[model samples]
Target: MTSHVFRVGNGHDSHRLADGGPLVLGGISVPHNRHSVGHSDADVLLHAITDAILGAAAEGDIGEWFPDTAEVNRGRCSSEMLLEVWTTIQQHGYSIVNLDCTVFAQRPKLGSHKLKIRQHIAELLKIEITQIGLKAKTGEHVGPIGHEEAIAAHCAVLLQRTDSLV
Candidate 1:
């Protein structure tokens, strides 16, 4: 068995909001008047989750793997990026134990969409929906998040080593 049986990682991401519709979060499109601005599709939730997985595996960050400077990364789908990361970690013999995620947004309440988000993430990770925990919070009109100028997300993941190696 591996020297370490478990590992934990945390990740965060944020993006400025621009006037638009169909805000994408966790691979699901939500009805909103604003969308996140970034080189990719800018799904903050997925980005954070992808980072958490990479961190847990002691792998490089998402930016290192998918640099914004590359034209191929422009408008790339966040879900596809995440899947690639997931596949890499699995190849390294890491399996997810559980994941907890939080999203901060001032507009468009996310209570109704939480289930779908969890389900989608579970599908991507090939884990049970029960293994994922998700929460939504508002900035209460205080800062960039509260002012609806940006959206942010955080994710924490527990991973287990599945291979026999040091």
Candidate 2:
């Protein structure tokens, strides 16, 4: 069987630190004292992944689709945003083949928590956990992230066209 596959998109997202703000990461509310600074929930990882998918499919960027000023998105769940992205991809007759993403932060050792993040993303996209790749990195005390006052993420995605249902 021949399937069409030849597209790429990169997504990058970052957020400032909010002291005593709710720390929500990868759709999971992490136990951290500092939260992300943004109008929405400020999920750096999900934001990056969403952009990657939308970019790969040539749909559009996250901001255009989900404006921060929109009342529908005020303090909304990032997972819901991601699900909407999935819908957009499906609408374009695209399917996520695989995705690789990395999260950058200074505090909170991520080695042990990578699996949880991976599982949650897999469930959200309704794909196998193995298809989702999650990596965590520390800024090594070098930049704003190193100072533990910010977080960022990078996502690369591959999308392929499946047979049209119609």
Candidate 3:
């Protein structure tokens, strides 16, 4: 009988909004009045996805791998970060099965960009676009996100071991 092992991980990330920047999310540029603040490009969606992939492989998160204080990490593109982390995940003998992600924001509605975001992620992960699920939510004017002060993203990933123990 064939046996398979599956692992699941959840990751979340948030960044404060700031002026004079271009909003980058899911590796795609989104037109907005403000952008997320961070040492990297601050693509919250990609950050969450990277975290989920690392977590699934029992590896540390983005901060540990790419600290804000590191000069090499500053202003780096998040998609590149995700690719590097994905290499680690692949080396651990695991492959992503699927990923579901949600973005929390209060401005510049993301509804229209969902497909583009999903396609970008699918290309990054080398998976079918159908394997990526994207969702957007508003903060309902309750907190930092609600007040348009920040943007957040959450991602859940399922991974399976590709090698057989036999």
* Index of the highest-TM-score prediction: 1
Candidate 2 local lDDT, 18-122, one digit each (tens): 788557888887877799988789999999999999888778899998898899889888899999889868776777778999999987777777888888999
For candidate 1, what is the lDDT?
Answer: 0.93
TM-score of 3: 0.94
For lDDT, the strongest prediction is 1
TM-score of each: 0.96, 0.92, 0.94
* Candidate 1 structure quality by residue, lDDT tens digits, 45-72: 9999999998888898999999999999
Model 2 misplaced stretches (Cα beyond 4 Å): 1-4, 164-166
Worst 10-residue lDDT window for candidate 2 reads 1-10
- Greater-TM-score candidate between 1 and 2: 1
User: Per-residue lDDT tens digits of candidate 3, residues 7-62?
Assistant: 89889999999886568999999988798998999999999999998887778899
Model 3 misses residue 62 by how many Å?
A: 0.7
Better of 1 and 3 by TM-score: 1
lDDT of 3 at 3: 46
